[model samples]
Target: MTTTQTFGELDHPSRLLMGPGPINVHPRVLRAMSVQLLGQFDPEFTGYMNETMALYRQVFQTQNRWTFLIDGTSRAAIEAALVSVLAPGDDVVVVNAGRFGLLLSEIAQRCDAKVTTVEGEWGKVVDPQAVEDAVKRVRPRLVACVHGDTSTTMAQPIAAIGEICQRYDALLYVDATATIGGMSTPVDAWRADIVTGGLQKCLGGPSGSGPITISDRAAEHINGRKHVEAGIATAGSVAGNGRRIASNYFDLAMIMDYWSDKRLNHHTEAASMLYAARECARVVLEEGLQARFARHAQAGAAVVAGVEAMGLSVYGDKAHKMTNVTAVVIPPGVDGDRVRARMRTDFEIEIGTAFGPLAGKVWRIGAMGVNARKHAVLTTLAALEAVLRGEGYGFTAGAGVDAALGVFS
Candidate 1:
C-alpha cells in the first residue's frame, strides 16, 4: 500500500524582524532569486559570477583580486579561511569578545592550530593594547578577530589590531559578518589580510553565500596549500608544496581556481543564492556605502533614544555598540520571554533574546537591512511600548515613539 501526505501551500505571517540578523531581505533581492537558473559553467552564468566578485570587492572596500563568495553560510567561509592558511600546529591568536569570538577559537582549534585566546569583556570591545601584547608574547602566525559580535552588540575596533598584526608580521583574519555592508570595513585601510562576511545582516539578503576577500599575502599563503581533485586535475596541475588542507569542500585554493578565469570546477554554484548575493551588493552600491551606513547609524540611534525614553537601559558599552543591533536591558521584575512572546503575538514583530551570560538580562533589537528606516523604527518602538505597558512595566505613555521621532526630526 502507498501512502500520501498532504501539506498546505507555503504561507506565513509577515513579521517585522527586529532581531540580530536573518532579517527581512530586500524585495529586489527576493525578485532576483526568482530568476531562472543557469548552468554553473555557462558563459552568462560565469559573467554574473565575475560581476558578483567585482561587486563584493566594493562591498568589502578592497581591491583584492581574490574576492568571491563561498557557497554556504558565513561560518563556512570562516572555516575555509582558517583551515586553509593554518596548517597543523600553526600558532593563532583569537581575540574573544563575545560568543562569536569563542567560535573563532573553536574553529581554529579544529584546524589543529595552537590557539591562544585573548579574552575581552562581553559587553565591550577588546583593547587594542592587550591584543598587541598578545601578539608580542605569542608572535603567532595569524591573528583572528570578529568585526562585530551581535551577542554583546559590540563592534570591535580592529584598525589598531590590524596594524598590530602587521607590525608582528602576522596575517590578520577578520569576520565582518555583522558589519560589512552596514558599517565601514575598509579592508585595506585596516590592513586586514583576509576578511569574510555574509548577506543576512546589513546586506539586505538571505544567508547562504559568504563573501570573502583575500589580500595578496593571504591568497599566496592559501595557494601554497593548493591541491586539485583528481577528477578535474589536468596534467599541468600540480599540488602545492605546503600541507594539504584537511577539508576538500572548504578549500580556498581550489575555490580560487573555480572563481578565477581558469574556471576549474569545485562544486556547482548555488545559482539562486548567487543571484541574491549579487543583487544584495547592487542594492548596497546603489544606495552608496556611506549613505547606507548613515541610515543604519540613524536607525540605531533612534532605537537607543526610544529605549532610554521608555525607562529602559541599553546593554553593552555605548561607546562601541554595533550600529545594526541594540541590546536593551530587561527591566527588573519583567518576564523577558513573556514580553518577547507578546511582542510577536500582539504586535507581529520579532525581537531577540540574549545568549549565554546575557540570557534573561537583555533583549536584542535590530533595525537593519531594509528595516533601517524612520517608519520601521517608530513602528517597532511603538509596538514595544505597548507590549511593555501590557506587561505592567511603567513608563510615560508615547515616550518611546516620541523619542524615536525626535531622532528622525
Candidate 2:
C-alpha cells in the first residue's frame, strides 16, 4: 500500500481566519518551529520545556506547579482534565451555553461520569446563578464549562461559578481554548481549579500542543490518583494497583513528572511543538499581555462596529462577547457561503460561520493574536462592506469602517 501527494487539486486558501481557532500563527512562532529539534531528553530541550512551563504559568496567570503542555490539540487537555478528576459514576454538572458546552458534557459522559447539564440558549451565556442553582440541585462532584464557545463567540462567566463550586466542594474546570491568550482569564483570580487552552487560537502558534494549568488543590487530587506504572515508579512517585489509566498517552501525572525534576520519560514530547509554545508565549509577553489582549478586544470591536454599521446585525448578547471572536448575522437573502467564498477568492480574507442552530445564519469573524491589528481590522471591515454591497445587500456606504474607526479615535 502507498500514498501519493498532489498540490494542484488542493484549495489552499490565504484566508483571513476570523473564525474560532487555528488562527494564523505569528511569524516568530512559526520560525521557532523550524529550529533544530533536540532530543526530548536533551538538556537544551528540557531547559526550553522548563522555561516554556514558566512562560505559560504567567500566560495562564497561575502559580500552579502542575501547569504544563498536553502533546495533542486543545481537546487532549480537556479530556485529560475530565478523565483525571471525574471518577467513574462521579456526579458532574456541565454548564451548557453553546456547541462547545454540549461537547464538554458529551466528553464527561464518555468518562463514565454521571453528567447533568445547566442549559442556556445557543447565543446566550450560561448564567452563573443557574450553575449555583444546578450545583445545589445536582450536587455534582465536578463542574465544567467552555470559557468561550467559539461557535457563538461568547465568553461564559466563570468567577461566580468557581466560587459556588468551591463552596459546594466541587472541582471547576475551564476549557479556555479560544479565549485564553487574547482575552483576560486570570486563572487564579477566577478561582478556576483547572484550565486548558490551545496554542493555535490566541497564542499565534501551531495546533499540535495544549497548555493546561491545575491549582494546588486540583494537583493534590490528581497526584493522589497518580499511580505510576510499575516500570517508571520511584520510591516517592504515586503508585496504586488501580486499573491502568484509561488513556495511556494522556495521563498527566506522569507528564508532570516528566516536566518536573523527576525527569522520567513520557512518550517523546514534541520538541518543535514545545519550542513553538515557548515562542508563542514569548510573543505575548514581548507584545505585553495586557496590550495584546486590548488589541484583540479593539480589533474585534472594530469588526463588530464596522459590519454592524453596514446593516448586518451582530448575533447574541453584545455586552459580554469574546474579545477575539465575533458572530455576525448574514443579512437576509445573501448566501453565507457565497459571501465567504467571495471574501476568500477576491479579497483574500476569511471569516467563520456559526454551528448548529445558528448555522447558515451567522458569520464568525475573528480578531486574534497577530491577526488582531488595526490594518487587519480595517481591511476586513472594508472588504466585508464591499462584499456585502456586491451581494446587493443594502447598507450605508463606509458606515462600517467609520463606525469602527470612531472607537479608536
Candidate 3:
C-alpha cells in the first residue's frame, strides 16, 4: 500500500567523502551557486561568462582563445572535442590503460572513427614509445588519452606523447578530468591540442560544468565542421560544407558561437553551474596553482604513508600516481564492501571501491579539492584503521595515524 507523504525541507547527513570523485563541495563554491539567477543573455551574465573563460585560461595554463565551459560533466566535454574534430572514418589512436582510457576508445568509436588502441598494464602509465610507434604505423588523425584514470590511480606522462603527435601532425586530446586542479596540466607546454576537465574532482564544485581549452590547430578542425541549426540560422551563417557533427548538444563550434560576441542562442546556459565553476577557479587561483598542487601532493603522500604503515600495499607505480587519489590493496580475507559499510555507518566517511579488473582487489581514497587537507586525510586514515580492525584485519595500533601525522609534521 502506498500513501502520499509530503517531503519536508531538504536536509542530509554530513559525510567525509574520501573517494574517487564527487567529493564535498567547497563552501565558497556552494555560496557562489546560491547567488540569484540572471538571464542567459543579460550583460552581467555574459560578463560572468567572459570572466569564466579568462579564469580557466589560468587554470589550464593556456593562452588559447577558444577556452570555455561546456554546460555538462567531464564526459560531455570529451564527446564534444572528439565529435567536433573527428569526421566519419578518421583514424584515431587511443591509449587504453584504465577505465577512463577505455572510455576514450568507446566515445571515439561512437564518433565513427576507426579507433586503434595501445594497451598498458592496469597499474602503470602508457609508454610514450608505444604511443609513438602506434601513431607512426597508424598515421592517425587524432591521439586521445586520459591524464589520470582514477580507476587505476595512474597518471599518464603526456609531454613526450604530445611531441610525437606533433611530429606526426596529429591532434592530441587529453581528459584531464582527474588531474586538472590537483596537479599541473600545462596545456601549451604539454603540446596538447585539446584538453578537457570537470569541476567535481579537484575543482571543488558540482559536476555540471566541464572546462575545456583548444589550441588553434584543434579549433580550426572543429570550426571547419561548424553548422548552425536551421531554426536559428541567419543569412550571415555559413552553411558548413563539412560533415555535420553527430551530436547536437556536444557540438563545439556552435557552442563557441554561443559564447562569442555573436551571442547566438544555443541551449540555455546552466547559470548556477557556471557561477560554481567561476568560483572554483577563483579559489584555486587565489591559492596559486603550484601551492594547490603541493597541498594535494602532501595529502596524497600522507594517505600512502598511512596506508602502508597500516600494513596495506599501495597500488600502481608511485612515480606516476596521481597526487589526489590513492589505491590501497584490500587485505586478505577482508570483505571490501563490509569494511566500507562500517566506515560509512560508524565513521560517516566514504572511500571508493574499484572498478573493472581492480574491483574486489582495492579501495581508492581521494584527497582532492575541498577535502584535500591534513585533517581530512587523518580522519579517513583513523576511520579506515578502525574499520580494518573490526573486519579481522590486523595492524599495529596507531601506526596509520602516526605515519600520516609524520608527513604533516
Q: What are the RMSD figures for all models against the true structure?
A: 1.9, 2.6, 2.0
For candidate 1, list the clashing residue pairs, or say none: none
Alpha-carbon deviation at 222 in model 2, angstroms: 1.4
Any idea what lDDT model 1 has? 0.92
lDDT of 3 at 296: 96
Winner on TM-score between 1 and 2 is: 1
Identify the superior model by TM-score, candidate 2 or candidate 3: 3
lDDT over C-alpha atoms for residue 228 of model 1 = 66
| Candidate 2 Cα deviation (angstroms), residue 384 | 1.4
Task: Give a tens-digit lDDT track for model 2, residues 308-406.
Answer: 788778889888788888888887899999998888898888788777999899888888888888777888888888888898998888999899998
TM-score of 3: 0.96
Candidate 1 Cα errors over 4 Å, as ranges: 229-242
Backbone clashes (count) for model 3:
0
Q: For model 3, which pairs clash?
A: none
